[model samples]
Target: MTGIVNDAGNAATYAYDASGNISSVARGNAAVSILGFSPGSGAVGSNVTISGCGFSATPSQNTVQINGAAGTVISASSTQLVVQVPAAATNGPISVTSPSGSATSSASFAVTQSSAPLIGGFSPTIGTPGTAVSVSGSNFQTTVNENSLVFNTRTALLSAATATSLTTAVPTFSTSGRLAVTTPFGQTTSSQDFYVPPGAHVVSDVAVTGRMAIGSSQTVSLTTAGKIGLILFDGTAGQRVGLQTTSSSFGSCGTGSLQILGPGGSSLGSTALCNGNYLTAVTLPTTATYTILVAPIGTMTGSVTFTLYDVPADAAATIVPGGSAVTLTTTTPGQSEVLTFSGTSTQRVSLTLSEDSGLGSDCTYISIANPDGTFLVPSTLLCSRNYYSNVLTLPATGTYTIKLRPYGTNKGSGTFTLYNVARRRDGDDCPWWPRDHADHHGSRAGRVSDLQWICGPARKPHHESGQHSLVLLVDFEARRYGPLSLRGLWEQYIRRATDLASDWHIYHPPCALR
Candidate 1:
């Protein structure tokens, strides 16, 4: 078309076959521009990029060299190029070239193996019957099933295993131990236990026999040869009953139901079903104080009863504030005794002479009266019903004393018991009351620990708002005082509660939750 032709203005051209082999080539000088030099091709495993081919076609070359290295060509153009490097190639610079120009880029490739699984922990460490535990581990696949692993002889459903973790419920009929863990790659073996001890005494109380009505209320005590089990008051049966134990190790309430009966053995409708292996308190349902009978229910067993009479209160003597002599006397058989007083007077309390008709040692009594009348406490004479005597503080303001005839006739005497009550120190400024009255009373007097008895499980069925009365029937009977004193036993319970409270603040286990 143009008359003026320039040899230097012509374009070059090339060509190739479908197999990427050079087929034809040409060079242009001026007039006619050579349009086909042809694009380059590569092998299947070859790294490639396509660029710089000057052709009217949008995609002239299907593939070409990637900086003379093997890779995958993602895209190519006249000005730039892109490729996925072969796994065998380390990160390096890449370029593409054609008849017109070339293009280059920085890239890399990589291959890696799967990761390992992680473990959280095993469960049911105690190993109890019918206990369900979980084995927590990470790195599991979603397509797990029975064919996955032999879990306790059963096909375990290969559970959902994710890139992070996996879970499966423990199979039934599994052994009482830990199980094995299996994965696509390998297997692991481990085990755990499932039981814990119920920490408490597993025993009960015993039965009762004769009962009597004391002072204002009808009461009864149950006494056996050894330890007692259940001590209940059957208001329905009009009987003060209890269940005693032959064996000291276990008792009735440990495994049974106890009820308070009325006249004719009819259920007073009070029943306490022992929920724990050992119980702290189980009361009798009766406004009238009665004893309870502990009986075994099902396979459980225990025994206990209520016995022993207790005096409500009595006069305890100490020097009066007006300097009057503190007169002390024993209505029952007076034996072991101790008297204490505190005030301003510094005079010794004398024995104001005791009169009794029963026989036995009378004058061989030990009496301790503060010479300066500052302080006189219980005499270490150990006075039982076997001993009898009277002690008096003679106008002693600050001191106290107790007289005890350890070996003597105690029956029919006006005073057959001893009183060893404690009082405030005399003459030390601060003065308290009730000097000598507790010792000579029933069983053990004034000791809060003597109360190991419960009253009733008598359901105060939900009625009108607050119509139910709290009927507490107590039966305090001695079985064996053991080596522990009443005061000591009470202290132990207090200490236990304190320890539990402290632990609640620490680990704060599930049971401690509100």
Candidate 2:
């Protein structure tokens, strides 16, 4: 046996000689002392080990900081630590801080630069919190502990790893940011980001006027002044909802956008769309049926018909680039299909949309919107049930929304496909980049490109179709980004991972990160 930690969180470390016999076992030590670390030096994302005493048993409580950056502790014990170096780390003294005390190695750890890890694709892009997310990439650390898995800024629990792939779960407080894996070789982040919405499911469709109630839908027109379409839906005390109103004529509200009244005829909140049509949300204060007052905005007039949408802020879906075409179906006249993809400002993208043939002409209408429920591309009504998008430049960095609705009460079905688009530059977000040691935030660091991410320096070419890639067949969302309180969620991840230990494992040193 190499080493074992007792139930008291006290660990005994052992070193064996070539003869298969124990050489040294340090026990009963309390002071934090560094026996020294191996390889002596490595790159920014390099993984390393430090032998010592008086380290905390809870791995998350151990802080291994090299220079000014804090390393991620994969596993630890009272006598040793296994950590992946931080991207911001540099040549400096290795300091280990635990709940028990602090220890500094006498020797300084060296930080060198190397080829960074690169991402090719990821699977099951849409998920709620705690969902397992698998990433396909290159130059990743072979050993799981040697690589750091992070979503936004929260460090995810590393489940497995290889040279080209890694597995982790959506951290509790996960919102937005590309899947970033830091390794001894370097660091690489995905071109696309991940999202975690609250939850979403189709409630109902209101084609013909019906009673205003939960799961019941209604369609109304605001052609004349004071024309209002009202709806009443039961809401839980803390439920939040997003309402989307679609129509053959989808336009902005000039004077007033829309009104949402709570129980007892009280105004809860109001949502307005800037350019394109979207449903903003409001939190319900009590469990009761609430009224949705849809009135004309600005100078909107005529028998202009619009669809109603009550999207409860949490549910969403995703599309795999260069994968199979997704079939969208609408059983009711007022229903619409919504799809999303990650994008950055100035990034160009392409798409193909076609309605199921033989359904007659002029049945489908499509539109692309910004992350804030505004217009990126305005609505386009297809006359032949076929639409091909132009090379379009994205205006911001976030999840872009795509909406498909049947025009003018014409119920229809269709297929939509988005080609793979990755934006990068030399020594930027692309693979094999050996210069920058910091995280590659795509929006600010690179030029827009739709080129394939091969295992070499990125090159430019007219974007092609059907690129060979692992297809993700599940739904995903661009986790909306905002100020998140991480203390509660972050602790859950760390404690959950810490429980996986046998309550007595001691890591050994002299292992190289690569």
lDDT of 2 at 453: 24
Candidate 2 lDDT at 361 equals: 35
Q: Pick the candidate with the highest lDDT.
A: 2
Instruction: Name the regions of candidate 1 deviating beyond 4 angstroms.
Output: 1-228, 233-307, 316-349, 352-377, 382-514
Each prediction's Cα RMSD?
28.3, 32.0
- On residues 392-434, what C-alpha lDDT tens digit does candidate 2 reach at each position? 6788989988887554344456677776554544554323222
Model 2 sits at a Cα RMSD from the real structure of 32.0
List where candidate 2 sits over 4 angstroms from the true fold. 1-261, 264-286, 291-316, 331-334, 344-346, 357-365, 371-374, 381-384, 395-398, 406-412, 420-514
185-269, model 1: which lDDT tens digit per residue? 4465443221111112122223333333321222222234322232322132222222212122224334444444332234433
Q: How much is 87 displaced in model 1, in angstroms? A: 92
Q: TM-score per candidate, in order?
A: 0.20, 0.27
CA shift of 420, model 2, Å: 4.8
Global lDDT scores for all candidate models: 0.33, 0.57
Which candidate wins on TM-score? 2
